[model samples]
Target: MKNTKVYASYRYPSQVISHAVWLYHRFTLSFKDIEELLAARGIIVSYETVRNWCLKFGN
Candidate 1:
C-alpha cells in the first residue's frame, strides 16, 4: 500500500481547519457559502468559527 498520513499524526486541527477556511474565504464565495458546503457534509462548524479560523491562520 502507498504510504498515507493518519489523523492521529496531525499536530493541529486548527491548522487544518484554518487551511480549509482560507481556501473558502480567498474565493469569491460568501461566508455562508463555505459554511453550507461544509455543513452539508456534516462538518458542524459555524461561519463565524470559519472566519476566525481563516484570520488566525492567515496571519
Candidate 2:
C-alpha cells in the first residue's frame, strides 16, 4: 500500500482534499464556488477550509 500517512492528520479524507485542490486549479474556481460544488455532493466543507486546503496542497 502507498504511504498515505501524510494525509492522516487531516480531518477530511485525502481524496476530498485532492479533489478540492484539483477543482481550484483545473477550473480556476473560487473557494466559495468549490465549497458549493462539494456541498452539492454532500461534502459540507466551508470556503475557508477550501482556501486553507488550496494554500496547503495546491502547489
Candidate 3:
C-alpha cells in the first residue's frame, strides 16, 4: 500500500520529528517546551513552527 502526505521545507529528519511528537504527546508538554528541548540540541526550532508540524505533518 502507498501513503500520501504533504510536508513542509523545514528540512528536519524524520527521526527528530518523531521524537518531538512523541515527547509532545507522552509528556503533555506545550509546543514551546518541545521546541526548547530540541533547540538545546542545536535544532533551531520555534514553538509556533513545532505546533504547526504537530498539527499537520507530525508522526
Candidate 4:
C-alpha cells in the first residue's frame, strides 16, 4: 500500500484535521468560523489549531 503522510504527529485524527482544512479552503471561511463549526459538531478545537492545520496541510 502507498504511504499517505498527513496527520503524523497531530493530536486529532486525520478526518477531523482534513474536514477543518477543507472547510477553511472550500468555503474561504475564517479559522474562527471553522473552529465554531467544529464546536457545533462537538469537536471543540481552537481556531489556532485550525490555523495550524491549514498551514501544515493546505496547498
Candidate 5:
C-alpha cells in the first residue's frame, strides 16, 4: 500500500521511473541524455518528463 503510493498517478511503471531516477543520480548524464537512453530502448519519454521524475523520485 505504502509502496504503491510512491508510484501513484503515473502513467509509466515504477520500474521505469526508478530506472530514470537511478540513471540521473548514478551518473553524470543530463536529462536529455537519459531521455535518449530510454528512447533507444523504446521508452519514448521526453526530457521534461525525465526532469520531473528526477525531482519526484531522485534522492
Candidate 6:
C-alpha cells in the first residue's frame, strides 16, 4: 500500500493549505492577495505563511 503523508504539525488542515497553494499558482496571485482571499472566507492566515506554502508547494 502506498503511504499517505499527513500534515500532522500544521495548524491548518491539508485542504486549506492545498487550496491556498492552488490559488497562488493557478491564478498567479500574490501572497498578499491569497491572504486576503482566505481572510474573506474567514480563514485568517498571514501573507508570509502563504508565501511559504508557495515556496514549499509551488514548482
* CA lDDT of each prediction against the hidden true structure: 0.62, 0.90, 0.74, 0.86, 0.91, 0.85
Top lDDT prediction, candidate number:
5
**Against the hidden reference, what TM-scores do the models get?**
0.59, 0.90, 0.72, 0.87, 0.90, 0.85
Q: Give the TM-score comparing model 5 with the true structure, all chains together.
A: 0.90
lDDT per residue for candidate 2 within 1-59, as digits (tens), equals 15568679989989899889899999978999999999999999999999998888778
Runs of candidate 5 with Cα error greater than 4 angstroms are: none
Ranking by TM-score: 5, 2, 4, 6, 3, 1
Give candidate 6's whole-model lDDT.
0.85
What candidate 4 gets wrong by more than 4 Å, as runs, is 1-5
Candidate 1 C-alpha lDDT tens digits along 1-59: 12223324534364457546676757787667778877887676777877766665455
Residue 19 in candidate 5, Cα distance off native in Å: 0.2
**Clash count (model 3, backbone only):** 0
| lDDT for each residue of candidate 4 in 1-59, tens digit (9 for 90 to 100) | 13346567778878888889899999979999998999999899999999988998889
lDDT of 3 by residue, 1-59 (tens): 12222434547766677678778878989999998899899898888877877877555
Clashing pairs in 3: none
Lowest lDDT sum, 10 consecutive residues, model 1, at: 1-10
Model 3 spans with C-alpha error above 4 angstroms: 1-10
* lDDT (10s digit) by residue, model 5, range 1-59: 23867898999988898889999999999999999999999999999999999997777
What's the residue-level lDDT of 53 in candidate 2? Answer: 86
Native-to-model Cα distance after best TM-score fit, residue 57 in candidate 6, in Å: 1.8
